[model samples]
Structures are given as structure tokens and as C-alpha cells.
Target: MRTPLPKDKCVAAAPLCQSDGEIAIIAEFLPRRIELTRADPGCISFEVKPTGDPRVWDVCECFQDAGSFELHQGRVASSEWGRATAGITRSYSVAGL
Candidate 1:
């Protein structure tokens, strides 16, 4: 059985991108982004995968806590990936934060 995550100790989100240009941007930057995020000490898990729709991706990530998640956000905000995908639409939700 899996252990339950500590309440308010984890930050999770799901962001979706829909558009050919957005998809291409993801293809270019996501690999490196995933690599960097996964290496972060506060990252519990990070996964971004293409959905059944060719232009859509499923983005799921979990951080050790809200602070970690905010740190990740700040890092991304100044990164190449952030600039490239700035205008793409995303619907995100958070839990345990």
C-alpha cells in the first residue's frame, strides 16, 4: 500500500496546453525542464506527458511543499521555457498547499 501524503506538505498541479505551437514549445523545452525539476531536492515527483490529443499534454507535478513549488515557479518564470510558453493557455489546480 502507498503511504498517504502529509496534508499541506505537498503541492500538486495539472496544467494543460492546447495548440500546435504550444505543443512544439513543450517538445523543445520540456525534456530539459523535466530533467532540472526532477533533480531539485524539493521535488516529490514531476511528470509531463502527451495526451491522446496530439496537441495536448498532461502536466502533473508535486513538490515537497508550497515553498518548494513557489521556488520552482520563480525558477521557471526566468527560464527559457517560461519565455517560450508564456502565452499558452493553461488550467491549473493545486492540492496540499
Candidate 2:
């Protein structure tokens, strides 16, 4: 089920599962992505943290609204960070879309 969120607030929270080989790529690229994402005007909050499992990262991001989230998606899709993680597995739960 979708999490409860106001219509004007968008959120994505979940785990990013990485393979042994993908871990290096994520580590190399995620920092810059986090920097850029947090700088976005519509970003409310963003976080990515490593879990007890080395291969999993907990990701939680909130945007001002659906429009903001869509814009973020577009930006990421064309970004180098997006390309690097394109093949990585992600289990995300998003609401307010």
C-alpha cells in the first residue's frame, strides 16, 4: 500500500540493492548526486545511507510536490549518476505521485 502523504508532498523511501561490482560504481558516483539533488529548488529532503548489509543503501527523499518529483526524475535520467546506477536494483515506495 502507498504511504500516507499530502497531495502537495512527494516522497520516495526504500533500499537500493547493489551487487559487489556495483558497489564501487555507487560509491564513486552517489556523493555528487546527493549534492546536486539537495541543491535542487524543489527538494525538501534527501538522504542515502548504508545499512548493516554492505550491499544495501537506505534512500529517502522528499520533494515539494509531484511536479518537483517529475522534474527531478527528468534531471536524473540524463545525469551521469543516473547512467551509472541504471542497472542497479532498487526497491522504492513512492507516494503523492
Candidate 3:
């Protein structure tokens, strides 16, 4: 069996938006999600922050590679917690740091 080589993954930073009602739910979920993901095998870091705009928020995450990020995305997509939030908007970029 061939051992898989570790790949470098770029950091991603995104800005998110949600309705007022969803904010509370998102707030509760965000920290838990960060804590859980940060402990995952391939995760480097996961952080969530409130933006200056009331309905907008920011998320920064780092992973070992695209594969690891895809895994994380799958986990979040499957989360019932993620489904509850409506009117979400996201913009992602390759983080320099």
C-alpha cells in the first residue's frame, strides 16, 4: 500500500450573511463547529467572527489540502445545524496568510 503524501492547502476566508433570527442559532453553532473542526485530523484552524455589518460574519479555515477541505465541507453540508440558517451569503478567497 502506498502512503498518501501530505498536500499544501490554501487558507480560505469568507464573509457570510444571515437573517436576524438565524443569527442566534448561527452564533451557538459557529463556536461548536470551530472547536470540532479545529480538532479534526487535517484541520489547521477554524475561526468565526462577526463582521462590522450586523448581518454579516466572517469565517476563516485552514486544512491540509483540497481533500481535507472537501471533507470538512461535506461534514458541514450534512449538518442539520447548517440547514436551519436561511438567507446565507458567502464570499470566499484564497487567504494569503
| lDDT values for all models | 0.72, 0.76, 0.63
Measured by lDDT, the strongest candidate is: 2
Please name the candidate that would achieve the greatest TM-score relative to the true structure: 2
The model with the greater TM-score, 1 or 2, is: 2
Best of the two (1, 3) by lDDT:
1
lDDT of 2 at 97: 65
Q: What tens-digit string does per-residue lDDT give for candidate 1 at 5-45?
A: 46443443334566677778878888998998888757878
The C-alpha local distance difference test score for the whole of candidate 1 amounts to 0.72
Candidate 1 residue pairs in clash (backbone atoms < 3 Å): none
Sorting all predicted structures by TM-score, with the top scorer first, yields: 2, 1, 3
List candidate 3 segments past 4 Å from native: 1-15, 94-97
Off by over 4 Å in 2: 1-10, 13-18
Q: What's model 3's TM-score?
A: 0.70
Per-prediction TM-score to the true structure, in the order listed: 0.79, 0.82, 0.70
- Clashing pairs for predicted structure model 3, backbone only: none
